[model samples]
Target chain A: MILSDLVERFGHHPLGIGQEIGRMVTTPGLDNPPLNITEKELTRGLRYVAVEAPSGIRGRMGVLGPLVEQAEAAIVVKNADYAFGCSGCARANIQLIYMLRRKKIPTLEIEYPKTREEAKVMVKRVVDFLRGLGGTNG
Target chain B: MARIAQISCGTEWSGIQDLLEKAANMVGAELFFPEVDLESIDKAVEEVGVNAQSPNLRLMTARAKAVVDGAPAEAVLLLTCFRCAEGVITKHAIRRYLQEKTKIPLVMYSFTEKPKLGELLIRLEALVTLAEKKALLARERQEGITLGIDSGSSTTKAVVMMDNEIIGTGWTPTTTVLDSAEKVKREALEQAKLNGRDIEGIGVTGYGRFLLKEKMSVDLVQEELTVVSKGTAFLANRQRGEAMVIDIGGLDNKVMTLLNGVPDNFTMGGVCAGSSGRFLELAAARLGVDVPTLGKLALRGDPERVKMDSYCAIFGIQDLVSGLASGVSKEDVAAAACRSVARQVFETQLQEIDLRQPIIEVGGTSLVDGLVKEMGEILNADIVVPRFPQFGGAVGAALLVSGVV
Candidate 1:
């Protein structure tokens, strides 16, 4: 919530997968029935994955690729347990992180909070990272 | 206020609120996060079946119990993370369970720690729009003088309808969204020999629907998913029973299955424009012929003669260049491009659809006779082309807005 407030304050929209999937599931008359995603959106997703990837990658990419496209900057959490964040399709997750790196956008990699003390440090790091993006769009 | 039931594992554990307040406030929706005790989690795990030994997954299903137990939820968001294998499998299970178990609208999202706020606002806005404008989606008939404007990626289209029959249609290449909309709207009105004063209702749709609102008097603003199917059905005169509708437009393609003019399933977009009418336009530019001429020449050649089966527009064009350099006939090259687009749409979109008989093909590219023929041949089905296919979105918007007006 603090991060969201900060992102909003910084004049940048936060690009998240949840909202993209929500758009997909709610989008009327999409080709991906049972999920509300369009085939064209799926094709956009398909462009991200190599042809030789596993079958389920299409659906995941279809959700993630749009968010990545909207991102001006990214904040990736490092050293978080598998339990602390979204670990959707493992293959897609790794590739998406790699994609963020390759994008060469302003990125801040913070260690996940483990303790009360570590949590404070993480917040300070986040504040600094966001401040560093001053005068720059996220 | 609209109420959303959130079914999730580890949302709080991820240390984000899912921007709960922000999303809810944006949509004027009330968000609910149900809690399950350890006892309830244990009992629920049996029915949930597969959990990655993650209590979070178990708790997630337990949380879903509220909806099944008859809680008032206007929508449901099934959330998991991107990396949780067990959670993904479990999320799918919960999805199948909820789908089979309930009729509530379900939205699935994978959240990361510190998710972006703008994206969530967009989702919430869609939910609000779906709820508020639902009347536009389920209208069964149209009456009176109504106008619809469709501002698309490549073209602007307008249709004037009177008493359920299309009186006039205006089409122009899209340049400025508002200007193009006004031009097409004026053209349509001119053709109908009716001034704007005769129109009782006006609706706008497509990529520029919202833009028109600031400049025009609009009664309905709708998404193409429901409106397009409604339009196609009305145009094809297939408003009852089961049918499939395909629209190959200047930018994307839309394929939908409907029962009684309501879409139960549909997809909008090809793998790329290579699989859409835009590719046909590009192919015509390359072949030094108009789109209609390309269609005529395509009819004269065998599709199997020149190999240009690329489904990506850039690569598809490269294939066209390669085929031409190799001394392939222009007629054969046109046929291959048409057939290639047809084949790509078939492989990428149609394969996943529950195809109904009497496939109705609409949109500008539907007029390209050879592409239509190839698609018909590829599917072994007769493709129905409604009169004035290009104004499908316009017609649909006009038809749907009539309900509200």
Candidate 2:
């Protein structure tokens, strides 16, 4: 929520599974749900995730991969636990963060806050990074 | 035999030709690759308005040229390797180019060096459906009394008709698939002043089609791909030419390219609801307005006044909330929401095909003036919304089931 607010505050779009839950609902006549993107998108995602990874990994990569591809910049909050949600999509999230870093877009990774002071510091870091994105005034 | 065009550069080196031929044999289609002079690839690429260093990508324009210029081929098969990112982009360019340039049935695949039959069979079978069913697909009129029911993901719709004229339509938000179907069927029949026995036949289609099939004792059970096109054509009075149908539904969205009302090439699904009608619904609830009111508000507002960039409905809502809290008028937020959905659909779904004119926009979302207006502005073409657009799947079922007699 903090990240979404900061990005929107800075007039930038946020890319994350939480931001894209609508992808979970399958389109009419689509062959597969959750993973049912256009065939072209499916092909694009095929190269990113290891074939041997869990389907949860593939499914996560399937929807989130394209967003990662188009992401001009990204923010990662590492050491997040199950409370982070989407029922154990953490593995794919890990892979995607690595991808964003590799893409060499301006990126910032902050540890999940463990205390109130840490939470304040985390918010400052996010705000500072977002301000650096050179964006439109939303 | 159906003549199929084999368009690719690396098929010989990949050792996948046998699998392609075998799959075509399984579907009884004869495969033929269209060839142009080796030196013409550069000129063809320029003519097609796409540039790529891959000779294979350049060569794609040649095949597109031959197929569009009245080649004898009845279907097109496009292949490229999965490992090449350039191949995928060029392949899509070719697909879109072919869609605009010709009406021939086209299916594309990104293959591994050694492809298996299982990977290619279903796609080849779709080509067979188009080839063998051309006569039935070309039918422009419904012939008998029939009831069609579409048990869709978000709603159930029923259409009652007699001899090419629609008598009634029924719709309700979906709960239990079987119950919704039964309710709509009952409503349509009553409106038509008929009993179940008065209707000659019943047809079913949609996401919940199969569950309602045996219980409803349906006569024709077809998928949405064929059914929706038939409905769009019948309603739009364009059943005998090249027509395009864009159905932006509650949960997902679809774009179908058709010739004489038969779907030749199409793509459906959404990676984000920001592209689907559900986003509008969410925006409506947030704005304290109904979906219809939201559309009117969007027309009155200016998209330029709002600073919103939404790729996902969930995040789009965040932007909506922030704007609302910041004293942005509901109208601007609504316009922004509509534009966001339209842009998302264009970037994700519309980019997959080069649209044909006289585009018919159907499904529940078609009712939204705002969404349709935004889409039209982006595509720079007027869209036609047929009467009872939400009943596309049901109307299609009703139209085809008439042939069962």
Candidate 3:
């Protein structure tokens, strides 16, 4: 939400993997829901990852591909909330960052703020980065 | 006994009351705050025949009417936030209605995120001066020549007032405050064909007022806000109407409300270059255009095509560079930059005040054609840029020492 607010504040659109996937699935279009992945492959992940890995790391790239293609920039927030013994989320996080960096788009990675001061610093950093993309400060 | 009514957002009332009191005391007036509860607000809206959905606006409208009806105050002061959408939407109607009903003076002052103590004091002093019906400076029976010097950050302005008229005015780039003050003063004196000994008194204002005062013996050292308000009010009164004065300086911006030939309330921008003259200069430099030519270039561009998002000077430059790299025209980028500055002023600095027509734009930035155009479009009002806009503060200072304001 903070990332979205910052992106919107700077007059840029904030595209997320879940939102893109949701749109693809709900909207009528020639484009595939997961971009490069087949329906069969998605089923295999649902069956295999749900029972075996449970993290869905194998299908991470396919899901994130559309998000990266649509994004002008990316913000990755690594927090303990997602660190609760989920290997799939961890792997997907690293994969998403790698894919975003490969796209050469501006990216900001920071830990979730715990204290009020930390939150201020974190928000400032994000605001600065987003504003820097425009080549100015507010 | 002099009594003044203050109406403000309930949230800011506590924080600003002490400062308001101090200002009222300066002019020998007592401050009276109206009860700003929902019931009174509802009653006021009903009485004024206006429907207001926003609680803040309703409260302010109600309070203004309540003060005018209940308290026999000399004037009314309304404090509001620049970012309040509701306040901006309803302020004009409220002011007009209150004035018609009460037949008393009304002034509305808006603030950005944070309000500076010094700026607030200057505004309050102006209000108090109006409420108490006291002249800023005592007038002498015999008229003589008086010099007013405004040593600003970017420029020095001096005006020569002889027998109640501005006989001559001079301005030059400011270097050292003392040197610039002396140079401009000498230039004005030369133009007026008068000697230094002919000057009976000198009033100084602006960022370099103290420095100039230290170098030369001056009669009055007034605040920039005070003098600028006095000057704009004097000009507007000559035209015979109320006006909102916007002064965009090199580093700061000031907004003053003039009612009945007096500055009743005012506001100043924060320490950000986003809305200052420096931002326009920086944007122009980055665009490889002269500062004076930037406005013309912007005027040629499509106002709808270019949209600058960031309000920061540095970020605006980046946006311009990126736009150029992405195949955006120079004209569009320049236009977008001008729009962004205007947006910052209207949406951030002057957001809370309901803008009326015939806006008196003063200061060096007022000379920017694109900025003035964009401001008119954004505010949907007629902008009146006075001749010698940069000399407003200096002229006001002269008027101050001459006992005209």
Report the C-alpha lDDT of model 3 over B312-359, residue by residue, as the tens digit. 988877877788788878788778877878867764456434455568
Supply candidate 2's per-residue lDDT for A50: 30
- Model 1 chain A, TM-score vs. native: 0.77
TM per candidate? 0.63, 0.62, 0.60
DockQ of candidate 1 is 0.02
Per-residue alpha-carbon lDDT of model 1 for A51-127, expressed as tens digits? Answer: 22344665677678767776778887765676553535565665566566556788887878889999898778776
Q: What's the lDDT for residue B310 in model 1?
A: 66
User: Any runs in candidate 1 off by more than 4 Å, and if so which?
Assistant: A1-138, B1-71, B75-101, B105-136, B350-353, B377-380
How well does candidate 1 match the true structure in TM-score terms? 0.63
lDDT for each residue of candidate 2 in B318-400, tens digit (9 for 90 to 100): 88888888888999989988988887777566645657988899999898889889989877899898888998889888988
Clashing pairs in 2: none
Candidate 2 chain B, run of 10 with poorest lDDT: B82-91
The whole-model lDDT of each prediction reads 0.75, 0.77, 0.68
Q: What is the TM-score of chain B alone in each candidate?
A: 0.78, 0.79, 0.75
Error (Å) of candidate 2 at residue B173 is 1.7
Q: How many backbone clashes does candidate 3 have?
A: 12
